[model samples]
Target: MGWIEKALMRANRWHFVHSYRTIIAREKRKHPQDRERALMGAIGAASRADFAAQGDAQVAVLRHHGLSDGMAVYDLGCGIGRTAQALLRDGWRGRYTGADILPELVDHLRAQCPGFTAIVQRKLAIAAPDATLDMVFHWSVFTHLYPEECFLYLQDIHRALKPGGRLIFSFLEFEDPAHHTVFQTRTANFAVNGWSSVLDSFLHRDWITLWARQIGFAPPRFTSGSDTADHPAFWQSLAVLDKPAPA
Candidate 1:
């Protein structure tokens, strides 16, 4: 299964790259006057409303986990600097490191947002030292990563976080019959970019919890409903996991 999945992923690499180009072209057409919106569209979030909602959710999770000024933060899949922009706009003095897989988008983010550090990272990895980051946030990242990539990224994130550091990520939780078609089609690795399709995805709460434990994290905490969100919206629910401090 592993080898077969790897082969398929390699075959689909072009599709992913083409998808970005296609998005950039379309977003440029749709928001010619607003480059920021166009860039957001290129990163799989073209709609400003949806982008704002997800960014807000990310900030809420950070604050809920005691995020404060001057703390070091690592944002994985930092699409268009949405979370970083929000954090800075709200006066978060924390050192921000925004990393993404897309180089073009990262270039745009770095050019536009000079306050935070941005990098284009490859190979499903975070470029930070062990026990270095105070918090790590991953929004809508796992939805596209293959299972193995997910595990590998989680391992890398675990290595970067300090003891008692908090890791917040969003996933497409397996729920309801509406997702049946996608699940039946893709099983573990499904992705059709720009089709509102949850690609390379499908996860359960227990599966995430088990993986967290195996990655040396404490028990995972799931937050849903209105506990953190200002308004009920179509954003991913957050899972807060912690690393154990010294004995």
Candidate 2:
């Protein structure tokens, strides 16, 4: 891209981030005491019922990807324990740790799901010790982050995962027709309404493959967003990366 195109992209990103922060501040002011509302707003969830349903579907996907008893799992950007709640309800006997940038969400997760560890993180790094986790997953987290930001987080996730450990994350890609709808919606919102908190970002498969190779992760496996028996409501694409075990 040319310098002019780069400048335009930067300006657009700034606008989206500013608009999103404004929306979050407004929600906090409007519902200072309503934890559920705050949590839903932060994660863009419509209702507890919908949240629970999605969480259950996510757990199904995780199970399909080899989630089982006694494994240590990390939930990055784990908003309000959506997957954690589902895992608990399904009687999953695993050490589950969740972390998010929002303290209120983390606190609510702790209150709602006892025995699970929740942390409020402000950086792109994971809080776990090196090579301690069996699995780490992000649901609708990378869709809002820039490519560089996503790469940094993946690097940290690699550090936190044990050899051969798997990492699963959902992202939006332009190759999928359905994902174009997300971009269209955000564009219309910004054009007509002048502001929208939604920062829908799309990633290319080549970019992910390159990042995985550069970070020493095993080749990534991609699952189409349309393949949705496990995570029916989520339309974002999924990528699975594994840390290579020593020879």
The candidate scoring highest on TM-score is 2
lDDT string for model 2 (109-180, tens) is: 999899999998757899999999999999988887778889999999999999989999999999999888
Score every model by TM-score.
Answer: 0.80, 0.85
Backbone clash count for every predicted candidate, in the order shown: 1, 0
Tell me the spans in candidate 1 whose CA falls farther than 4 Å from its real position: 1-10, 13-18, 32-34, 44-46, 176-200, 225-234
Instruction: Give candidate 2 misplaced runs (Cα > 4 Å).
Output: 1-34, 192-197, 229-233
Clashing pairs in 2: none
lDDT of 2 at 205: 93
132-152: candidate 1 lDDT, tens digit per residue:
999998887787767777888
